[model samples]
Target: MSEPPRRNDDALTLLAVLTDDASRAQVATITGELGDRLLLATTIEEALAHAAREPIDLALVDVGIDGGAGLALVHHIPALRHDARVVAVAHRADLAHGADALAVGADALHLLPLAGDTVASTLAAARSRRLDARERHALAAALAAAHTTRRLYDRAMSALAAGEVSSAAGLFLEGLVAGGLAEGLALYTALGGAAVRVAAIGSLSAAPEEAAALEALARPGGIDGAYAPLRRDGSLVGALLVSGARATSTSILDLATLIATEYAAQRRARAAMTNIDDVGPALTTEEAFLAANEHEIARARRHCRRLTALVLRGCGESSALAVRRELRSSDLVARLGPDELVLLLPETDTLGAATCRRRLERRLRGLARDEGRGPLLVTSGAATFPHAGDSLAALLRAARARATAGAPYVALDRAVHALPLGELVPTLARGTLAHFPSVAPLDVPFPGLLALAEQLCVEAQRAGLATYLATDHPGRNLRAPARSLSARDARDAAPTPEAGQRDVRPDRRAASAQGSSVELRGVAHLAGCADLLVIVLRGEHASWAASGRLANDRFVGVHTHDPRLADLLAERLEEGHRRRNPESSP
Candidate 1:
């Protein structure tokens, strides 16, 4: 019996991995009669190569090929082509051979002197099974996509319900991007008579002004690429701008409407709350402070602004009042405990917070003297956003730790230890290079420092850590030449290379050849020590800094795990760079 010929699209492609001439000829004849394609492979490599290039519907394996190696190919065929069926062809019907074939993922076992009718029936059944498997696989993918979409929606809604409108917008944009609805999205709220972007995700090239103009002109009915207007009670409250080939304007519009409604309700509720004025300057309640802190943190993250959280212990009402008076009206002051106060300073980096702490300490000391009290010991600690910590809890914990320790910088200085340049370079590079950003001594005459710095830069780039390299020797190349170096040359050049340092040189070459994302800034001069090299790495989860000044071939500067120290050094380096190159872009 002969099977009917299949149409062009329905035709199956069969792979026959056989050493037997008879079996190969039989497979070719069967495929020819069935109107299907047959690929002949004598080795496993050839069969895999054929499957890699094109789809294979079924595979026939000669169990005796290469002394049983062909059986292993049956396991791999299905992996390469998910729906490909395998049949083991044995010289004779042996129970052991049949069991071995079935154990290795063969769909069926066929004995030599194969019948054409049996082969045709097996091919038809395999085709049916392949089609069913493909359908099931597609259905599973669709279900997974739907589940992901629903999860993202629930998370965004939860943020919205928590009164975090900016966070909600960010979460929603992330969800849309994750769900393939948009490549980029920006959420704009009507603020101070213009559309202001509150949150953004992915690659959006539209300028703030352009986004605002687009929001102003956006209408209810627009194309998939156009802005979606957010309206509440017929009044336009905000807008959503999405960019991508897969952008769904209708879904975005509905989400915008829901967000706008919730936002309007929140605004009305806030307006209805009664405002109370205190007779004297006082700290804000912890609850109110936390709420405001969260809002400020969200704004800071959105705008790429800096924020500082300071914790001061051993402060009385008089000292608290002094702190409140010393701070700007925009700063937030709240009592965290009976004698501890927390201050939120927006647009403040570590250095700014340190300066504020010094000023406040002086004011408190004078107040204590005037009140005829003993020397007031007010210990304070400060942590900056995107540096010391990203969240309130993290920032508070860092700040509290610093306050408990005497002076922040003094404590950091105490932690610093002197080490040989050879030892220090590898120690810093190998240990916590990824966990913390680093600052190294760059002014050292040692050539190894430059190589180590370059190696660290490459490692940081590979690890996805944002790196900043500053040096007084701007003329020196930070990266090694893009060529293979001998083991002796590497050792002589670096003295103490990091573990697997040789393996990562290719990454360095690629990074340099590709134009590394690591920021390199050269100043004509550096404050403190011209030989000082500062390596700072900033990451979402952690920050690290190592600043070393070479003295008598020894690195004798501070290295701290404290992110504030790293941030402070980074800020100073940036400031120095700006002073040296006034017109250059940062």
Candidate 2:
């Protein structure tokens, strides 16, 4: 015989409040018809206490009990349990309080002479409300996940921009974890017809056949787990294997695609670094060091000798020469930049590399003292072949990553937060924006336009200027009035008899003074009051050029595609300020 179906642990629990014996019997009959587990409560306090202890899916309050005390308790049911749906019950004589009960908080009203059909319909409405609540919570959770993924993706891109591939991989893994994968994340690369696991969060205990299958699969698919292949220029570089249920989520798929694309880009960049020798023969070029260092690694591999790549920073030629005097002729030294150098030590393992690093640090310290220069900060990293890494790019990345994470041998105290606002803000601006009127890309999902508008106001405050954020987005959400246009609401913002100049004020009775902060439908209110104006235009909609005529003298047009909108606007205002004062330098 076939086994009976299993019951779901998530069955709904209902609370029924009825004082009279007949009323209690009727509620029991109704709950039995609905097929929900009923918890009987004789008083309001009893129902409330039960709700506080456990999740209450539905609450049925009898209004005839204790002279309408049950009607009043309906309001408190939802407060005790947000997801609980309440239905107020009233007898024929007490039906007057049905509407009032619903007005307070009840989801619906169930009148007396309750039949099986009426009870079924009322419970159905309660079920619908429960579904709506669940959907609302799900949407909120998805949005929060999207926001977290976006933040991590941005950080990973920043690391990739700096050519820190290993660091980027680490950041990408962090994003994956934040996106909900608990464990069993691994990155595997194909080397010499075999797949090798490069980085992993947990043990990659898959058998040889399973590993080979993972490497062979072109698309993301799995029976026991999932693996997304990382491809570069049509050729497979590696694959990212993830286990568990979260691996099948839309967010994980998106993250996997992003990582694969970035990996391809990084690989292409590494390939280009191999060709940079054609540009110049200068030893100071980092590309030159990277290009020439591979041969040294290959020779060491052939000879079965240890090859160490040491990355050095914050030292000069004299200091390098001092270290060179301490090295053998077999060791290869290449200057990467003014304050950077890559040293290839033949037959030297991690221990020998550490010894050399210590001697260099000591020599640099003495040199700093003799030259009266603040102690020469020497930050270094070492990666040895066939031990720390197998490939040139990998070895270089490992060493560079170490150098960044490790401390400067001499103190420099270059913390950005320690700087004064006057000095710090300009430095940040310089780092973030290379030129003025920077064109940034915008991405608006529904109410995103409003968020962008508010960001503009914040930027204006930072620049100490009264600003107006104008958008030609004709969507109803954009029709909010401008707030704090000037010191007086009468100036410029007051509705005038002039055509095309009348203030487009929001209904004051319907909106607060801060309503303008939420929306800026028209520019008529801030015509002359705002010193700087930021105009947001949708790429698919009417642009600033097509939006009637100019309302502000100093304005910058920003599209959703444009990034760093606030920075661009601030830069524009500074440029205008500089132009106004011919002798001032911005």
Winning model by lDDT: 1
**Candidate 2 residue spans exceeding 4 A from truth:** 1-11, 20-23, 96-100, 180-183, 191-196, 202-225, 245-319, 322-586
Question: How do all models score by TM-score?
Answer: 0.40, 0.44
| Regions more than 4 Å wrong, model 1 | 1-13, 18-37, 42-57, 64-84, 90-96, 111-164, 203-224, 243-255, 258-586
Question: What's the alpha carbon RMSD for model 2?
Answer: 21.2
Model 2 TM-score is 0.44
lDDT for each residue of candidate 1 in 1-586, tens digit (9 for 90 to 100): 1234454766888888877777677777878877887788888788889889878889887776676777777788889888788898877634466569898778888887567776788788877886787789888876776678778777676566434565666667777777777777776666545666666677653525323443554656532345667776787777777777465667667776666545544443343222211113444455555654566676567556677899988788888888878776446677767788888776566545655775686688789889988566677888888878888888999999988765444433223223323334344434433423343323444465555555544454444323354444455454242111222223333223323211222212112112223455554364444566566654323455666655665444545546555555555566567777888532
lDDT of each: 0.62, 0.54
lDDT string, candidate 2, 129-157, tens digits: 77777889889887887678678777666
TM-score of 1: 0.40
